[model samples]
Target: MDTQDIARPRLSEEDWLAAAYEMLTESGVEAVKVMPLAKRLGVSRTSFYWHFTDREELLEAMVRRWEERNTGNLVARTEAYAENIAEAMFNLFDCWIDPDLFDARLDLAIRNWARNDSNLQAQLDQADTRREHAMTNMFLRFGYQKQDALIRARTMIYTQIGYISMQVHESKEYRISLMPGWIEVFTGSRPTQRDLDRFLARHG
Candidate 1:
């Protein structure tokens, strides 16, 4: 029988990863124990072990995927945008910089876990650098010099991360929403009407 013709009832590797991701987001990394993971997937522990040798291995894969998900399609699309860069920046930051991006409880729990875990710290640093580099590249594409791009990229990311770090504590979004107007601080000053006119003339 053709594979498509038969009922395909088996769960996929993606399904397994999604379940693992949920466990990580809903609870903390500590909550993603081997038994709990198998239970979440409605699979035998044997089946789980067949796919992954242990929780540590699964966590390695999870962090790798998380890095890719963050700095891959999402950032790539943001940087490749042809439309309003400001709008793209806003939407992109909104996702990452939202405390609601994942469970607040989970976020706090993971933050604590990361402080003690070397692997987790390394993964976080890798993610941060990749994100910064991607944003820096985008700024460079917009005619910024390499030094200016690095400064601006670092400024943008730190500002967003700081906003979200507080967002989880405050359970509010208003402050970060007001960020764009603050962009002038990154620049020397607010753009003059003449400056805007000149910039548009060149880029138009």
Candidate 2:
């Protein structure tokens, strides 16, 4: 083999998936074909088959990643230990700002893709239910009535979804400035200075 052939590196499953994810995020699902991914990765298209059985499988894997990262982390955050309801609220809110805990871009991409696919839309609905249920239980643990917890949970999650859908952009400093008011609006109590300080430290 020539030196150029020896120098070429093989693409891994994650490499292919990462490329596909970029396409999905940038140009929507229709742009996530194997050929485009191969071109973007500078590898032969067959490399994708080494990891995924087919294009459908790749798409399914993307959805699974979304669920595991976004939904799973949100649920876990709702279950995190806190001294008070305000602290707990900030724990869950961390998902909105932390990319490691939540992928807002992937969430938006999946939601846009789901618009044309009933099956995907159903899955999206189920994920929303799961997140809302977790947050509702969180409020209930903090002494909210069942009905109150449920409505508050819905309002909190729906507002985040609305922000994603509208592609709203705000500076971190500006958003953080409003967290105190938003916490009161969602949880019926304003956070203490200590609670806000703790939350800011985490994000900062």
Candidate 3:
């Protein structure tokens, strides 16, 4: 058999992006270079250009993924159906526990990356504003005054972002135990027994 006839592993754009995303969450954006990713994927460095034009393109794709997965899910969750504001909040809280709805690691990675990148920082600010607005609209939908809605939305978002930035660790059980108080504080109403039951069942 001729060595030239042997086939190298075929890699997809997602394969490259996934490797970059992992490096991003584990190390930092600086660690997400093409050579490192190619090495990690066991592919030729040239193979990267087949998917992305360059490192900058790959980085932008990562940002798009973060925006779509984290910010998109958050906005959708805020608009999820519920009988009242407190129940509505429980829907949003699911983002804290569900990685599908919110990739906290990616969010944190982007924040850290933005510290040294002004353009990315601008994008992050825009995303934060969008998320805050979604929460504010959620509150307004349930009859809160515009001023109160904005305040509560900022409070909820800032508190959650703080938890992510601080890398707070807590057991799911422990966090669930605190849900009622947190919900009441954010929504200005304690969840009814039914609301708590529904929320608990969703997690359970």
Candidate 4:
């Protein structure tokens, strides 16, 4: 190896996790083994031991990172203050449209991983419940009754889940066109032109 290659910055845990996440998306959970990751990083397998105890540990770290980043961001957006339910729901549309904020690819990859593992499925279940509760709280804060809020929250979340699972393809313009109707269905109130304008400004 070149001296310059030997002198490259040492890999960190985040480096490994980032590579693992990429492998998870491009390949699958099964492809996230240590040797492959090390190969992908152009490092020795022994280097992995410096950051993680084993493959399982690295997988756990990946899940934790996903939960903190994706799920946490969703909840934060759901709880962001809005002048009304319409605006609050629009805030959440940010999550759907913004890959940096809520990685739909990673989310779908993890869900596919959970299919055969009961333990991972349990974790996914917990995340789903937490996210639903956050949406419900948003509706409740907007003065929706408890029952109505819960139902609307489920509708919004489940619809998104189906969209991801089905791998539905639509142009941004097409999806944006449907947002006002979606907001009406989920919030029971039509978004004014201002609401549509604000959402378009950010996501259009």
Quick one: best TM-score, which candidate? Answer: 2
Candidate 2: regions farther than 4 A off: 1-7
Lowest summed lDDT window (length 10), candidate 1: 99-108
In candidate 2, what are the lDDT values of residues 123-175, reduced to their tens digit?
Answer: 99999999999999999999999999999999998899998989888887888
lDDT of each: 0.60, 0.91, 0.90, 0.89
**What's the TM-score of each model vs. the native?**
0.64, 0.95, 0.94, 0.91
Give me the candidate number with maximum lDDT. Answer: 2
**Which candidate would rank higher by lDDT, 2 or 3?**
2
Off by over 4 Å in 1: 1-10, 81-113, 168-204
Sorting all predicted structures by TM-score, with the top scorer first, yields 2, 3, 4, 1
Check candidate 2 and list the clashing pairs: none
Clashes per candidate (backbone, < 3 Å): 0, 0, 0, 0
Give per-residue CA lDDT, model 4, range 1-204, as digits (tens).
Answer: 434336677789999999999999988999999989888888878788988999999999989988987899999999887888888988998887787889888999999999988999999999999999999999989889999999999998889999988888887788878888999999888999998888788874
Number of clashing residue pairs, candidate 3: 0
Name the lDDT of candidate 4: 0.89
Residue 194 Cα positional deviation in candidate 4, in Å, after optimal superposition: 1.4
